[model samples]
Each structure stands twice: as structure tokens, then as C-alpha cells.
Target chain A: MARTQGSHSEITGPRVREAAMRLFARHGFAAVSMRQIATEVGVQAGALYNYTPDKQSLLFDLMREHMDALLDAWQQEDPGGTDARARLEAFTRFHIRFNTRRADAVFVSYMELRNLTGENFAAVTELRRIYETRLEEILRAGQDAGVFTLAEPRITAMAVIALLTGVNTWYRDAGRLKLDEVETLYWDMVRRLVGG
Target chain B: MARTQGSHSEITGPRVREAAMRLFARHGFAAVSMRQIATEVGVQAGALYNYTPDKQSLLFDLMREHMDALLDAWQQEDPGGTDARARLEAFTRFHIRFNTRRADAVFVSYMELRNLTGENFAAVTELRRIYETRLEEILRAGQDAGVFTLAEPRITAMAVIALLTGVNTWYRDAGRLKLDEVETLYWDMVRRLVGG
Candidate 1:
């Protein structure tokens, strides 16, 4: 019976997470309740507890999963053997491509951070720092190779991340530019920003 | 008498707005109640209604005031007669300086925007656009004068605003870099971004 329940959760868990992220993005974490999430997922409030302990855990799980996926995806896409310029371009395009597709997750990740518990928040921050450090490493390599000129690699990494991530706030699929064109435009901007 | 009550409100209205902004910044708009704001202001819930009709209005009022103050300050600081590069640097530094000073207002302005009614949201967006247009105009002016090379002024303006506004997300007074240093670094990035 426990094995069977685990199998069931493998299916329902993602559904619950999807519902929770949507509601949290729309109504905010503090305003959203477990019952509402249950209603959205077509489960009783009691049954929802089987998947997650409470709303805080639900939120933390969502954010943790987001960070985990982000870091994992970047790890796969990272061009470990490439030169600094090539690696920086890959990271730039990958961030915009990945984040634009998951707008809600990105929004919730940035907005609801204050609602997380101290330990949960620290974990999320660590994951975020790991991601930042990836880009920082690219900058450091470029600086060492004299391909990129920046006063500080860490600060440039943060600024570059902010610039790329800001794309989600205004991008539209139906807009004039295609995603490829946007990637190019942003790449040009970032390339110039670091004196590439 | 109506005149006496109006006179009383004149003094308390700012206090009420200050309390609402603080509470809304601490807890989200949906999570905070009028009673809490009233208590923060040392007034009864019923008395709070005298200044603003409801919670939504209070939120709208706070956002409106923030935007208004932002635009007004930028207007006074805007070097209308200067060239595009000079104007851009002024806007960049002024934005960082002004927004960093009013962190609460900036936080609520970005976070609680979803809680606003359609009309209120539209109003705030309009104010925000007006501000964006100020930067876009400078970009356009630069492009037209053969000084700044950019494909799209509007998108570049949005990107620049995101880059500048992002300082508030990570900047700390006790950190190594002073605010002026930050402004200079960002100005360098922006100047290069536009090929200035």
C-alpha cells in the first residue's frame, strides 16, 4: 500500500506543485491557503497534507525545485571546455531561454523570497549564489584572458544576470521580435557591456 | 464641521499613507488589513476610512504617491538642455539615488502592483510608462544624433531601467562600494551598452 501510494504521488505531486505555483504567483504566498490549492488540484485539504506538510513547505519545495532545475539545467548546458566569450554567450542565451519559458516560476522565485523561513531562504540563496558563481566564473576566465574588461567580475555577473532576467518582465511571444532575435539583441548588449 | 475634519485629515493623511506603505511593504497588500494599518497609525479602523475610502484606495494612493514623487524628482533633476549621454548619466544616477533612499516605496511599487484594481493598475502603469518614456526619449535622441547606436529605443530603455533598478535588490550601505561608485559603474555599463 505504501508503494502504491508513492506511485500515486509521483503523478499528483507535480499537479499539486503546478496548482500551488500558479496560485502563489497570482495571489501571493501569504494570501494563498492550502485549501485553495487543494481545490485547484481537485483534492481534499487533508489529502494535500500527504504531499506536503504545510503551505510553507509547499512554497519552499516549489522554490527549491525551481533552483534545483535551474542549476541542473545550466550544468548540462554549460560549455565547460569553451573559451570565456563562447561560454558567456551560451550562459546568456540559456538564461533568457529557460526563464522566458517559465515566467511564473521566475516571478514567484523573486517575489515570495521574503516569505520563506530562514533556513529555507538560506538554502535557496545558496542555490542562487551557485548559479551566479557560474556566470562569475565565465567573467573571471574572460578577465584573465583579456577578452572581457570589467572592474569586478562578481558585480558584472550580477548586473548581467539582472539584465538577462529582466527580459521576462516584458517579453511576449506575439511581439514583433522572435526569441532568436531577442537572444541576439541581448547578447550584443551583454557583449558590449563587458567589452567583449 | 466639514472644514474642521478636513483640517484634521490634512495632518493625519500623510501619517496614514506612511503607515500603509510600511505595513504593505512588510506584509503583502492582501495579507494586511485596514485595522492593522489603523493601529500602526494609532487610529481606529473606522477613523482610517476618513483619509482613504478603503484598503484598495490606500494601496492606490501609496503607489500613486510613489510614482508621482519619482516623476517629480526626476523632472527637477532632468537636465533638459543637456546632450543625450549627459542626460542618460543624470537619469541613471538620479534613479539609483532616489529609489535607494525610498526602498519601501520602491518595494511596494513593484510587488503590490498585482493587488491593484484594473483601473488602479492602469494608473500606476501609466505613471511608470511616463517615466520609461523619459528614458526612451533620451535613447532616441542619442540614436538620432548619431551618438548612441541602438536598434530599438523602447526595449533598450526598459533594459536600462531594469539594470538601474536592480541595484536596490542587492546593494547594501555597509558593502564595499559606495553609492557613487555604483552609479559610476552602472553608468559605464550603460554607456557601453548604447555604444556611447
Candidate 2:
């Protein structure tokens, strides 16, 4: 019963997450069943208990994992660099890449957070706010440095996030638009958003 | 069964739609049972068929009605006759007003269309495309007339829609941010986006 997908002896966690992500995306979070996810993972419904406490945990697990990966990817791609324009572009590329590549995860990350319980929801909420705040701070720094021209950094940040997230709603893995092309369009828009 | 929440005559059409709106927004379109909607409307499950032939029809009926009202509001407000910036501002205000007033209907209108089937889906799809295209044409006209400055009119229109739609994910009937305040913030961002 102890299973982790890539770990030494555990395959349960990742498998359950994979099943949950697919179901949650295709059907909204509240509609999906634990039994359905268990079936998809090739485990009995009871076997899923070893991996998650309940459906809400399964939902949070997918969301938190995606956010962690997102933050990690950003940091790994640009470790300890704080140039505003560069950071903005990096953020643009990272968002487009991660969001487009993981459409289900990104969709659930945005739409299903409300389903999480008090503490679980709090953690995800705080992390998301921190990510957004850092982006705004970078924009403000750019404004001060005279590299980015923007009005209302916080509003612009929210607009950028909304615009970038829209990419996932229509972007198909094999869609006509390349991820880089989409990324470029957003960068252009955000640059303009910030008066770049 | 009949409903008269506002200026409606009977509970059948409006009542069915009202119930569907709440259920769809709460549980989503695909997950809500026709029987449940019937119960919410105070009618026998079979009697609900008098108004809508099926669940998809019930869903599409509410969507088309919402969009129709939205289009009517835009026209009644004389959104078209104004200058580019005014027209854009009209759009910002109209969007917030419609979505806020009919929160449940607007939620389903934006998020639950894919659940519609056959002619029901096509009708909603075409109307939606037509509405969005109207915005795109405005941006294009503004850009061509030199009143607006946007690198890409089509993308700008879509981004504006995204910003407006993002309102539903967080809006409350009574929140720290009032609808007018949110509309103002969006208007500013939209003007910046369209180079107003």
C-alpha cells in the first residue's frame, strides 16, 4: 500500500495525483469521485487511503505540488537574480511554459482552491499571495529604476496574471500557437502593461 | 410552477432558469441533475420538461438569456455611439454590472458552456463569438482611427475579457471591493491595455 511514483518504495502518491488531476480537469472538483480516481490509478478504492486522507487532500496535493513546482522552476531558472525587466521576462516565460505544459494542474490550481479545508487552503493561499506580491515588488522596483513604465503595479500584476492564465483556457498542446510565441505575445503585453 | 422574482409572468421558464443558475454555479453544469433543478423549482421532475427539453437546453436557455440581456444592456446604454475610450469604458462597466447582478447566471454563462450539446452548444458558442468579436472590432476601429494604441487589437480584446471575467472568481455581493470600485480598477487597466 505504501507507494511513491518515483521514490524508493512508494507509487501511491503520484498515481493518485495523476488520476485526480485528470478527473478534476475534465469534471469540476466537486463532481469527481474517489472511486473513479482509484480505478484510474489501478488501485482499489480503499488502497487510495494510504496516499491521501480524503478527496480534499487529493485536490490540495495536486494544487500545492503544482505551485511548488512553479516556484522551484522560477528559482532554478534564475537563481538570486533581481533585475526587474529580466525578472519580468523570466516570470512571463516561466508562466507560459508551466501553465501550457501542465494545463490540468494550472486549471485546477486556479479553480479548485476553494475546495480545500481551513489550514490546507490557508497554506496555498499564502503561497499564491507571496508569489503575486513578489511580482508586484519587482514591477515597482522596475518603475523606480526607470526601466518599466507602468501605472499601479498591483493592478498591472493582476492583469498580467489574468492574461497569462487565459493562455491555458485556449492553448492546446498541439495548438497552432507555439508556447514561445504565446509567451512573446504576453511579454509584449505585460511590458506595455508596465510601460516598458 | 411559476416564479416572479422580477418582471416575469410565470414560475416555469424563469423559475427553472433561476434554479439551474444556482445549481450550476454551486455544483457546475455537468454535475447538476435535472431532477434536482426540478425540485428547486417546485415542480415535479417530469413537469420540468415543459420549459426545457433536456438538461443542456435548461443550461443553454439560461446562458442565451443572460447574453441577450447583456447585449441589450450594451445597446440601451448607447455603448456604440461613443468614442473609442468611452466605448471601452462602457464595456468595462457593462461587464461588471451584468456579471454582478446575475452572479450565478454569469458564472454558468462563462464557465459551463462546454457542457452544452448539439444545437444548444452551437447557439451559445456563436452568440459568444459574436459578442467577443464585437469588442475586437471596437479595438480594431479605435486603432485604425488612431484613437487607440495597441500592438494587436484582437489579443487586446481577449485580454480585456479575461480581466473582466476574472472578477467572478472572487466577487462577493458585499465585499471590501464594491462592484463600482472593481469596475474602476478594470477600466484603468483596460484603458492602459488599449492605449486609451
Candidate 3:
């Protein structure tokens, strides 16, 4: 029984998350049910409890994982150097690329924040603030070096992130501009915004 | 009977819309039901049908009205001179102010786009494009007059709008910054972005 349950868990865990993410992105957290998720995952509704305690937990887990992956990916992609300009450019391109590829997760993360319980909301909010701080630190470093001009580093960081993430709204791979072209266009704008 | 029905609608129509907007903004369109909206409006579920055919119509009407009001407000607020720089500044401040004032409508318009049916989505998308074109025209005029440096005016317009609309996510009337100060900060960023 232990061996059978272990195998089932391994196979269904990722499937459950993928299904939840897809459904939540499509219909939103408040609208989607455990039954609907189970239907999507090809599992009995009772089987889903073995994986997640409730829909809120599932939503929180998805949001937390999205943030964790984003931070992790940025860490790996960080062109570790003292040059703030280069780091900002790297960040611009990286954010647009990462978010466009995971549009569903990005949409879910942004749209479902109100549905989270207070404690869960706080946890996800902190994770998001940590991610935002990554860019804020870069901006501050640049300010310290006199490499960037800004009235407020923190606000600039938020604006820059918003600009980059906005790409996911209308960007299509089949659209007129290629991904690199989009990145370069945004990079140029960011460079100007920061006076880099 | 006709006079009584007219009087009831005159009072209940706006209430129904207000409740729907508040609920949809809080819980998302897909999660909200006409019954729930009616309950919030102090009406029967069946009475909601007297106001809107269905939830999709309500969502679409809310979005359309938001966009229409946005466009109309900008039209009224436009500086309307040949100076692209002045016009762009007006747009930056105007967008931030207007959107922040109607945070719930803005949230619903963006977050519930996926919930809109195809025809409704297209209608809203067209309206949004028209609004974006307002900014794009400013960018293009700036570029034409050598007042703004832009690789793509359309993309720059979208970026600026996103950056301005982002203020709604964090701005509060009781926050440290006054509305005018926030507007000036964003206007400065917009100037830098456009090379004005």
C-alpha cells in the first residue's frame, strides 16, 4: 500500500499543480472548485486532498512557486558584475522573456491576490516584495555609483517592472516583432528611464 | 405599471452596476453570480435580469463604460496643442489620475478580460486600442517634431500607459506622496522616456 501510494503521489502531484494553475488562470481561484480541478487532473475529488489541503492552499502554493521560480531564475541569469547598466539591461530582457513564457502563471499571480487568505496573502506579498527588492537594490547601486538618475529608486524599480511585464499582455511570438527586437526596444526605453 | 418599472430601474440600475463592479473586482467576474450581485444590491436574483441579460453583459458594460469614460475624460483634459511634449505630459498625468480614481473599474477591466465573450472582448479591445492610439499619436507627433526619440511609437505608448496605470496598484490618497507630486514624478519619467 505504501509503495502504491508513493507511486501515485509522484505521478499526480505535478499534474495537480499544472491543472490548478491552468484552471485558476482561466476561471480564477474563487470560481474554480476542487471538483473542477480533480476533473481537470483526471483524479477523484477525494484523491486531491492527498496533495493539497484546500483550494486556498493550492492558490497560495502556485503563487509562491511562481515567485520562487522567478527569483531563482533571475539569480541564475544575473550577469554578476558591478555595472548597473548591464545588470539593468539583463533584468529588462530576462523579465520580458521569463514572464512571456509563463503568461498563465503571471496572469494568475496578478489577478488572484485578493482571493488569498490574510496570512497566505501576507506570505505571497512578502515573496513578491523580495522579488521587487531585487530590482530596487540594483537601482540603488546604480544611484550610489551615479550611474542612474532618479527621484526615487524604489518607485523607478516598480515602474520598470511594470513596463517589462506589460509585454506579456500583447506580445505574440507570431506577431510582427521578434522577441529580441522587443527586448532591445524595451532596453532602450529602460536605459533612458534610468539615465543609464 | 410602466411608470413604476421605470422608477425602479432608475434607482436600481446604478445600484446593480455598482454592486457588480465591487463584487467582480473583489472576487472576479467568473466567480460572481447575478444572484450575488442582486443580494448586494438589495434586489432579487430575477430582478438583476431586468438590468442585465447576464453576467457577461454586466462585465462588458462595466468595461465599456470604464473605457468610454476614460476616453471622454482624456478628451476633455487634453492640452490640445501642437506641442507633443505638453500633450504627452498631460496624457501621463491624466491616465494616472483617472485610473487611480476608478481603481475597481480598472481592475475589473483588466482582470476580467478573459471572462468576456469573444464579441464583448473585441469591442473592449477596440476601445482600448483607440485609447492607446491617443498616446501613440502623441509619441508619433513628438518623434516627428524631433522632440521624442522612439524606435516604435506604438510600443512606447503601451509602455507609458502601463507605467502610468501601475500607480493605481500602489498609490493611496493617504500615502506619503500627494497626487500632484506623484503626477510630477511620473511626468518626469515620461519626459525622459520620450526624450522630451
Candidate 4:
């Protein structure tokens, strides 16, 4: 029986990505070399190439996967057929929870966009726009339905996202506030910001 | 006549700092080299040491100077005899104006903190804490005076700062909204966030 492509890659692909994300987040994309990533993964550089074509591809893949997972996770958490206020609440809680769990991915996604190739950068930016549009749509729905009172959905979306993602900087598992409590505090501010 | 240390350094010091900031912003701090910085400053690598002790010192100095300037600038902007609402409004406007003007310094300040030496990191973090404390104090006064109704002044301060600094990410001089207009919109959201 011949070996399948899946067998060879399934075992190594994830390790390669994990190592790449760690290195990229720690030392940054431009400073990190493929050899360092391979060493981190405990594989030869050639073996690492078998998983990713190059460092740029690895970075693009990590970021793309992060955005894809975020969108997918939000879809699962979207609570369809709900009111705008309820949906907005879901987004607030969901973004903080999802982002805090994947700190490295979140950091790399924000920090390394400048290092991506033009096409890759566009692709990543479009994915980000899709995520932003999801929030904007919710805000727009709220504004139209008279449940939210923000004038500019686009700028409001950006502000809300920034506010929520900022939690990753100071949040600690053993810290003063539990995650749920933190969520409540943030949601209160978010609701107030939009004049709910 | 011997050259005075003050005269030679006054000319080169600012240039060296400028070159380092540009390189650090363009590339990750770890990826930047003293040689590259020296070249950018149009000085020999040996001559670069005359301006700064080492690359770490340069990074530390740049970050420290940025924070110092920020604190100094805010002090000048502070409304000493105003009510909490008036002072809060001043801070909101002042932060956005100051941060946007030094986008490169702001970028490096946030992005390169992980590369700072432990003591250097602590010094920078203390500066950040002082700045955060300033905002928190305003929020506290507002709450005490029954002018603002936020529950957590500390978290609110962090969130507001994040929201304002986020303007750096997407703002363009030629964009539709003027700076004052941007400040107004942010101030509106901010005032609402604090339930004023």
C-alpha cells in the first residue's frame, strides 16, 4: 500500500504551525528564520519546508487560519434570530473569550500584517474586514431597529472592537475579576457607549 | 579648541534617535542592528556609540523619552481648575491629538515593549501606569462628584485609552473626517461610556 499525503502531513503540519506562531509572536516574523522555526518544532529545515513552502506562507497560513477560526467561532456563537442588543452582547462576550484564549494568534494577526506580501496582506485585511463587517452589520441592525443609538456604525464597530480586544493586555486567569465578571463590566461600557 | 560633548551630541543625538525609531518601527526591534541604525544616521558604527551606549540603551532611551514626552505633554494639557467632565474632555482630545501626531513613536512604544530589558520594561510600564492613573483619577473624581457613573474606573480608563489609541491604526490625514471631527465623535462615545 502506498503512503497517503494526509499521513505524512497530518502529523507535522500542526507542529510546524505551532512553532511558527510561537517564534513569530516572540521574535517577530522578519526576525525569525525558517531554520529557527524548524528547530523549535524539533524537525529538520527540509522537513519543515515539506509542511510550509516558506516563512511568508507560514505567516499567511497562521493569520488566515486565525481569522477563519474567529469567523467560524462567531458564527457558532451568533445566536441567530435574536434582537440587535442580544447579538451585540454575544459579540462582546464572544470576542473577549475567543481572543483571550488565543493570545499568540491575536498578537501575530495584529503585529505582522506589515510583513505579509501585498496579496497576502490584502487577503488577510479582507478577512479582517469581513469580521469587522459582521460587527458593523449588527450595529447597523441595532441603529435601524432603534435599539442602539450610535450615529456611525462603522466607527462604532471599530471602537467597540478595540475596546474588547484591549482586554487581552491585562486579563489574567488568577487576577481579581473572573472572566464572566470582566465580561459584564465590559458589556456595560459597550452598551453605554452605543447609548443602549 | 576641543569639541564640547554637548555641541556634537546635540546635533547627532536627535538624528540617532530618529534613525533608531524609524528602523524599529519599520522592522522589529530585535531584527534591527546598531550597524543599520548607524548607517541610517550616516555615522560610522563606532561613532554611533558616542551617541548611545548600545542598541538596548537606544531602545530604552527611545521608549523612556516617548513616555516622558507624553507625560510632560499631558501635564501641559491638563485643565487644573476644571470640573471632572471638563478635564475628562480635555484628556480625550489631548490623547488623540498627541498620539496621532507621533504615530511612529506610538507604534514602536506598543510593539517593542516585549523586547525591553526587565528593568527597562518596568520603568516603561511604570510610566504607562502613571498615565493610566491620571485617567483613572479623572474617572474617580467624576464618580465621586456624581458627574460620571462608571463602575470600574480602572477598567474604563484602560478601555478608553485602547479605543483612542486605536485611531492610530486606521486614521489617515486625507481621510474624510478631520482631526477635530474625529475627536468630537470619540468624545461623544466616551462621554456616553462614562454615563455622563
Candidate 5:
């Protein structure tokens, strides 16, 4: 029975996640209760339990999935042949693309992180650290190649991430600039930041 | 008797706000109850009624004050005889200074803003818009004066605001870089973003 329930929940998981992500992003994880999420998802609160063990687990699953996808997307790119500037461009493009489409997810990923605890918090934070460390590694490589002039590659990477992630908080498909235009603008800033 | 109670409540208003901000920021507005805030503040739950008419008012007041102080701080700066770059310098400095000192309030201002209602929500949002519009004006001046080469002044302004406001999320007093150093690092990024 447990296996059947788990399998059935897996089938409806994405729908539950989508509904929860919107509510969590809109109301915040701490403010939103499971019943509200179920209502939003067009299910009874009890039926929602068939999807996730609890509200916190539901939030954690969305964030975990987002991070995994982000890492996978970045990893799949063959930035090997790209020079420092080109690689930076790829990073900027990917950063903007992933963040823009996942505004609610990104908002929860960035802000509701504190709602996670113990092992869950550690796992999420570790993924975030790994992602940030990858950017720092790129900055380090660029500096090693004598192409970037940043004084502190690590902090600069953090600043860039902060700025790039900032895109999600405000970007709208209907907003003033197209995604390409915003990417170009960010690229300009990144290029100038390290004197590329 | 009610007038004396009101005056007494006035004295505790800021303390109540402090309690509410901390709780709302830590546990989120929906998760925290009046009893919790009262317990945190060493007052009876009923006594909190002497100050905040409701939990939403407490949050609204905090958000409003944070935005107002931010606006007031920017206005106090004498941007006279300053070019776009110099004004940008002052802007970065002020942003870091204010956000670092009141990270909680700043976080509440950004994160819990949706909690406000009716007139309160509109008022807080208007103040925030005023600040962003002012920054855009400065960026536009920079572009017109040929000191900046951004494609869109307004979009660039939003990015800068995002980059700076994001500092409050990760900044800590014990962090390796001092506040002054962090401010300079961000100021450099802002300068480069505008082709300075």
C-alpha cells in the first residue's frame, strides 16, 4: 500500500509542486499552510498528503529540484572551447534564462531558504554553495588566464550571483526589456566588472 | 484612561515593531501570532492591542518606516557638484550603510511587503517606487551627459538596485571584508556597469 501510494503521488507530483511553489512564493513558506496549498491545487488537504509528507517537505522538494536542474543545465554546456569572455557570456546567458523562467521558484529558493532546517537546510545550503563555488572557479580560471582583473574573484563571483539572481525578483515576460536585451546589459556589466 | 493608555502604547510602539519585525522575518508573518510577539516583547497578548490594531498594521508600519528612512537618507545626501559616477558612488555607500545596519528591516521591507493591505500596501509601494524612479533619473542623466553607455537607463537602474539590495541577504559583520571594503567593491561594479 505504501509503495502504491508513493508511486501514485509521484504521478501527481509536478502539479502539486507548481501549486505549492506559487503559494509559497506569494505568501512565503512560513505564512502558507498545507490546507491553503491543497485548496490552491484543487485538492482536499488530506488528499494533498498523498503527494508530499508535509508542507515543508513539499517546499524542500521544489527547491531541491530547482538546484539540481540548474546544476545540470550549467554542467551540460560545452564551455570547454570557449575562451574566458565567451564562457562568461555563456554563464550570463544561462543565468538569465534559468532565473527568468523560474521567478517563483527562484524567489522561494533565495528567500525561503531559512525555512529549511537541520539536514534539509544543510543539503539546500550545500547545493547553493556548490553553485556559487562553480562561479568562483570560473572567475579564478579567468584570472589565471590574465583575462579578468578582479581583485577578489570569490567576492566578485558572489556579487555577480547576487546581481544575476536579482533578475528573478523583478523580471517579467511583459516587462520593458526582452530577455536578450537584459542579458546583453548584464553581459556589459560583467565584462566591465573584471575589465574583460 | 484610554488617552493615558494610548500614550503608554506610543512609548512601546517601536519596541512592538522591533518584536514584530524580528518574528515576522524569522518565522514569517503568517507563522507568528500576536501571543508570540507579546511573549517576545514581555507584554500580555492583550496589551499588544494597545499598540498594533492588528498584525498587518505592525508589518505595514515597519515596511513604511524602512522605505521612508531609505528615501530620507538618499535625499539627505548632497549630490551637488557630483557627476553621475560620484552620485553612484554615494548611492552605493548609502545602500550598504543602511542595509547592513538594518538588515532585518530591509528584509522585512522586501519580503513581507505583500502582507500589507489596502492603503498601507499602496503607500509602502509608492515610497519604494519613488526611490527607484529617482535612481533611474540619475542614470538617465548619466546617459545623456555621455558618461554612461547603457542601452536602457531604467533597466540598468533596476539591476543596480537589485545588486545593492541583495547585499543585505548575505552580509554579516564578521565577514572577511569590512563594510567599507564591501561598499567600495559594489561601487566599483556599479561604476563599471555604466561604463565608468
Candidate 6:
């Protein structure tokens, strides 16, 4: 019975989170409710409590998971080397590729940031700062190697991240540029911006 | 009576928009109701119809006004000259300054776009494209003059705008950098970005 219940929760947990993300992304977080999320998951309203304590928790979980996954994915993708330029290129490509595939999550992560509670907001913000620090470190290392010229490593990292993420605003599979071409173009621009 | 009615609407009209913008920025457009907006404006729910037909109209009007204002402001600020580099500099500074002052409208303009009707979305998108085209024109001119190195003028325009507008995400009045310093930093980056 314990094994069956454990298996049931493992399946239901992700479904609940997925449904919540879809609904929250479609409508804003404040507009979506636990009842609506439960409905979307084909469960009773009361059953949602088994997965998340409330709607805020669901939103926070979605955002936290998105950040955590981003950090983890970048960790796995980072081609650590003494060459900061190559690592910066890897990051530019990885950010655009990873974010475009998870457009809805990215959208929710940005749009619903204002809706997170104070504590949740801080948690997500800190995670994002850590991600930005990773890019800053690359820019700083490049500067140290005299391969890049930058006035502010932290600001440049933020600007570069925003520029890459902006791809999601207009990118479509049927669009003129393929993902690979888009990544290359942005990477080139980034390289130029950093004087690398 | 005509003069009084005209004056009343003129005053109430801005008040209504301001209140709606505040509420929409704080809570998502989908979550804010006509009643709540009316309460915020110190008017009866029905009276809001005198200004805007409905919430959708209010949202579209706010977004349209934001775009229109942005375009007008840029036109006024554009230091027209044959020098593409100088023009690009002006645009970099202008965009950062204009957007930071109207953070709420900018936030709503981005966040509530998905909530707009199809027709409204297209209309706002066209206006945004016009704004972007303004930047693309500068990049193209720079490219023609052999001053800026760019593989894609349009894409670079989009990326530059994203980079500049990103100032809104973290800028605060009490931040370490004054507005002038921030603008200078970004302008330098933009110059590097275009190879100007």
C-alpha cells in the first residue's frame, strides 16, 4: 500500500504542477485559483491540497523549479575551461536554447515574479542572482585575460541574459530563423558586445 | 453645463486610467474587475463606462498610449544628424531614460499583452515594430557607412532594445549608479555592440 501510494503521489505531483503552470501562464497567477488548477488536473478542489498547500505555493513551486532547473542545466552544460570566451559562447547558446524550449515556464517565471510572496520572491531572486553571477564570473575572467573589455561585469551579465531571453518574445518554430541560426546570431552579437 | 461636463470627464478620464494602470500593474489584468477599478477611481462601476467601454478597452488604451507616448518621445528626442553613431548614442540614452520613468506602464505593457484581444495585439505590435524599425534604421545606416558590424540589422535592433529596456528590471532611484552613470555605461556597451 505504501509503495502504491508513493507511486500515485509521484505521478500526481508533476501533473498538478504542470496544470498549474499552464493555467498560470495562460491567465496571470493572481487570476488562477486552486479550484481551477484542480479542475485542470481532473481532480476535486480538495485534492489539490495533497499536492500544494495553496495557489501561492503552486506558483512559487513552479518558479522555484524553473530557476533550480535552469541552474542545474547550466551546471551540466557549462564547459569549464581556462578560456572564458569559449565558456561565454557556450552560455549564450545554452541560455537561448534552454529558455526557448521552456517558453511557458520562462513566461511564467518573469510575469509572475511580482505575484510571489515576500519570502518566495527573495528565494527566487537569490537563485536568479546566482545564475547571473555565473555569467558575471565568465565576463570577469575574460576581462582578466584581456580578451574582453567591460565597465561593469554584473550589469553586462544582466544585459546579456536579458538580450538572450528576449528571443522568446518573437521566436517560433515556423519563423524565418531556426534555433541554431538564432543562437549563432546572438552569440556573435554577445561576442561583439564583450569585445571578445 | 457643457463646459462642466467636459472638464469633469477630462479630469476623471486620466484618473481612471491611472487607477487602472496601478491596479493592473499590482495585480494582473485578468484578476482586476471593473468594480474594483471603479472603487479605486472613486467612481461607481457604471460610471467607468463613460470613460472606457470595458476593462479590455482600458487595457488597450493604456498600452496604446504607452506606445504612442514612447514613439512621440523618441521622435522629440532623436538628435537627427547624418552621423549614425551619434544617433545610436541618442537612442541608447533616450530609451533607458524614457522607460525608467514610466516603469509601471512598461511593466503592464509587457505583462498584459497576452491578455489583449487579437485585434488589439496586432495594433500594439505594429506600433512596437515601428519603434523597433526606428532602431533598425539607425543600425542599417551605420552598416551602410561601414561603421557598425552587423550580420542582421533587424535582429540586432531587437537585441539592443532588449538590452537597453532591461534597465527597468533592476534600476532604483537609490541604487549605486545615478541615471547619468547608468546611461553612460549602457551607451558604451551599445557602441561596442554595433562596433561603432
TM-score winner: 3
Candidate 3 structure, TM-score to reference: 0.95
Q: lDDT, candidate 5, residue B72?
A: 88
Model 1 residue B1 lDDT score:
19
- Tell me, by DockQ, which candidate is best: 3
Candidate 3: TM-score, chain B only = 0.94
Residue range with the least summed lDDT across 10 consecutive positions in model 4 chain B = B1-10
* Accuracy of chain B in candidate 1 (TM-score): 0.93
Q: Summarize candidate 6's per-residue lDDT along A48-90 as a digit string, tens digits.
A: 6877788888888889999999999999999998899999999
Error of 2 at A18 (Å): 1.2
Q: Which sections of candidate 6 miss by over 4 Å?
A: A1-11, B1-11
Residue-level lDDT of model 3, residues B52-118, one tens digit each, is: 8888888889999999999999999999889999999889889998989999999989988988889
> Which of the CAPRI classes, incorrect, acceptable, medium or high, describes model 4?
medium
lDDT of candidate 5 over B123-159, digit per residue (tens): 9888978888888888887888889877777767878
Q: Count the backbone clashes (under 3 Å) in each candidate.
A: 0, 9, 0, 0, 0, 0
> Per-residue lDDT for A1-196 in model 1, tens only?
1234444454378899999999998888988899999888876677788888899999999999999999999999988874999999999899999999999899899888889999999999999999999999999989899999988788888999989998997899999999988999999899999999
Tens-place lDDT per residue, model 5, A82-143, is 38778888898899998888888887887788888778888988998888888888888888
lDDT for A67 (candidate 5) = 97
Q: Please identify model 4 stretches exceeding 4 Å from their true place.
A: A1-11, B1-11
- What DockQ class does candidate 1 belong to? medium
What TM-score against the true fold does each predicted structure earn? 0.94, 0.87, 0.95, 0.95, 0.90, 0.95
Q: After superposition, how far is residue A136 of candidate 6 from its true place, in Å?
A: 0.6
Worst 10 residues of 2 chain B by lDDT: B2-11
Report the lDDT of model 3 for residue B152: 87
All candidates in order of DockQ, best leading? 3, 4, 6, 1, 5, 2
Q: What is the RMSD of candidate 3?
A: 2.8
> What is each candidate's DockQ, to 2 decimals?
0.72, 0.45, 0.81, 0.79, 0.66, 0.78
